[model samples]
Target: MTLSPAVDAWAEEEPGAATDRSGWPGGIPSRVVRPRAVIEVQQLLAEAYRTRTPVIPRGAGSGLAAGAVGVEGAILLDLSALDRILELDADEQLARVEPGVITADLDAAASAHGLMYAPDPGSVGISTIGGNIATNAGGLRGAKYGVTRDHVLALDVVLADGSLVRVGRDTIKGVTGYDLVSLFTGSEGTLGVVVGATVRLIPRPARTATAAAYFADIATAARAVTAITRSGVRPAVLEILDGRTLAAIDDLEGTALRERGDALVVIQTDGYGAEEELEVLTSAIAALATDVQTATDAAASDALLFARRRALPALEALGRVLIEDIAVPRKRLAEAVDGISDIAQEEGVDIFVFGHAGDGNLHPIIVTERGAADDPVPDAAASAAERIFALALELGGTITAEHGVGRLKKEWALRELGPEVHALQWRLKEAFDSRGILNPGSSL
Candidate 1:
């Protein structure tokens, strides 16, 4: 394939050298294209499609799945420069934003208008809105407001042929065509590149409260999470951190929690003047907790909630982390947590478990020392992750609840979806990208 001079010239203008390597597992792309405008993105995609060259759409590169990893000969389409808030319709509670806007930046901007974009991925500070849309990311707030797909009202996508198509509607009601917006939300760049999005926002809650509870065993905490759901109390966020995870965080952040408890649950409730509502919910959660402590104010509550957000980074400090995202029926959370512990024991690997307990989504992080990628432990960790994923399937859960099936989980995705559904997904991919040059080997 001949590289167009225009493409080469555009690559030269990128901020960093095209071949700059990342500490991430896969190496960087041979060329990086940072388009300053949507039209430039279209031109880049057109060139790549014409030449049948691989192109990986990257946001902040904060993704754990290595979905942003570039192929050896691929072009890295860095969309971070397209950061712009095109519009904010306060009356409609929706905001139109460029793909490269940081997740936290959107949230902050929304908050200024007394509204919020609910999905709060851990890397919100650095992860781009486009990445969240690509993966249909979920977070602590997902229990209350749902994931990225739930809030997305519309999307402006650039297809494989460099043609732009708008999907979904800004209005609340519309059934004009297939739910392409939802379909592309979690396509992980295989279907198309998201250039901009109109996302729904909710009014900022007037009051908030949080409670921390300790359990003697992880299963006991898992049961409490089930109880909270059964009680019909929707928390803003419900998180669980096992002893190992707490210890890891303590070691990294100098905040001790493992010593005080074997398992921890952090629950928060927020809404319009939700103090009373939160207190009621806390009372119900306290009934299922061993040592329950409720925070009187938002400041204290945020401090407690910070532990969940810091869990992954804390584990990363210990060594390499193979983070797994598994979700099961909310009622079967205990079984899922127990299954993880069983896998850890059988594999004899150090694993830290934590995540959004409210949605039954658990992140079991397998940690091995840096530079130990070839060690037996890393292999054991991978085996453990596979076991945990299989267990989630057996329990009628999903292999990936939030994180997309990047190259790392592609093989397992076949197992999770079965042959029929998998083939159908491929057909859909072909329909959208006939030449199959878009983020090949990712998702379906």
Candidate 2:
């Protein structure tokens, strides 16, 4: 396929070349297109559509799954160059930003005006707002504020035919048409490429408190998460780490969990100087924990929270990581944890588990030694990964809770969604992308 002259001049044709390595899983894309503006993206997309080339729309590439990993002949549209907070409406509590604006940057900007974006993925520091919107990412705050889809008010998307279409309304509430915004949020670029977005923001909390609790077993810790949910006390962030994950974190941070407990539950709550709200949450946590430690100040609380957010990256350094986002009923969290443990043991793989326990979304990362890459072990890892996903399905849970069905999970997506739903998804894809050129092999 012949690329446009301008696109050819701007695109990087080197295989496995990426500006940032942290975001990509297996490696970088085969070709990278760094478009400075939406029109440039339009030109590139037009060429790709005409040539029938697979195009992978990439933001920060900080996704846990290999969502941004490019195929042999695919083009990686790196949107990082489009980073811009185009507009901020304080009165409306909404912000319009280009695809490449870093998630944390927007949050910091909003916070300066006494507002905050709620959907914060662990990689918020570097993950782009477009990526967050595409994946409908959920972080620690999800328990209280909900996922990316909840805050996204509107989106400006580039269709498969190089046409631009705006979906949803900037207003607080509107039911004028189909909820296409919701459809694209977690579509993983299969339906269309997001060029820009309008996200809702909430007032910045005046005060916040953090507490960490230790449990003798993972089951106890899982129960504590359920207890918090059952109690109707919503925390801004709630996280749990298994013994293996704790060890990985200690190795990375050069610190211990004080109690060396089998499991640890970290909870944070925020509001308008609601110390009493925090107190009640901490008290309930203490009831289910062997040892509870509450942070007295913001700095200390942030430190603890940082550790939880860094768990995935820290564990990844030890080995090749396969991150799984599986979620089940809150009350059945223990069963899910036990089932994962059983799978890990049966597969003879070292698995580290951690995630937003408040919402029952657990990320089980399978870490294999770097040496495993040279032998048949990678195959073993792949097989074990499949089994883990199947286990989640068997438990009546989703194979993916927040991380969307990227390339790695596409096969299982069909299994999870079934034939009827899968066919309908295909129909939707055809409607939006008749040529089947936009982000092939993703989601549907």
Cα lDDT of model 1 by residue, 1-444, tens digit = 333344343444554332211223454466877777888888888888888988888888777676777666678888888999999989999999999999999999999999988899878898899999988899888888899999998999999999999999999888998999999999999999999999998898877888889888899898888778877678888999998888888999898788768999998888764567667666766766668777757789878887887888898898877788889998898898888888989999988889898888988888877873333435787788889989999999988888878877888899998999999999999999999988876677
The TM-scores, one per candidate, come to 0.93, 0.93
Backbone clashes counted, model 1 = 0
Kindly report which residue pairs in candidate 1 clash with one another.
Answer: none
Query: Between which residue pairs do clashes occur in model 2?
Result: none
How much does candidate 1 score in TM-score? Answer: 0.93
- Model 1 RMSD, rounded to 1 decimal: 3.0
lDDT of 2 at 254: 85
**Which window of 10 residues has the lowest lDDT sum in candidate 1?**
15-24
lDDT of 2 by residue, 170-190 (tens): 998999989999999988888
Query: Which candidate number maximizes TM-score?
Result: 1
